[model samples]
Target: MRVKMRSKHRKAVKFYSTCFGFREPYKVLIDGTFVHHLITQRLLPADEALRDLLSASRVLGS
Candidate 1:
């Protein structure tokens, strides 16, 4: 299941990059709701989590 999800994420990133010119070191918007959910789910080190989810070289939050 995890592997499948990761593959899907990679595919999505590739598609976005190819068709939309989205570059690496992606910028992410972190809102209160997202922060709350992360805390509730105990997903610490938010930056790393976002980086992995986006297959980004680095994650820049706004």
Candidate 2:
């Protein structure tokens, strides 16, 4: 699944930058911290992360 980001968030910029294939640099200051945004070729299934978290929670009964 393709996730289109309409607006840039510093948190996301930092996160996405950490991923491989994402090297284009961008910046945002979040909570007084400077965050760098990088280009990324990685496309994650939007629901995959949530699904895993939910499944893990169910398994652990948390």
Tens-place lDDT per residue, model 1, 5-24, is 99999999999999999997
Model 2: per-residue Cα lDDT over 1-62, one tens digit each? 23333123434545665774444322222331211211132223423333332222222112
- Which RMSD does model 2 reach against the true structure? 14.2
State every prediction's TM-score relative to the real structure: 0.81, 0.22
- Per TM-score, the best of the predicted structures is 1
Q: lDDT, candidate 2, residue 15?
A: 61
lDDT of 1: 0.86
- In model 2, how large is the Cα lDDT of residue 35? 19
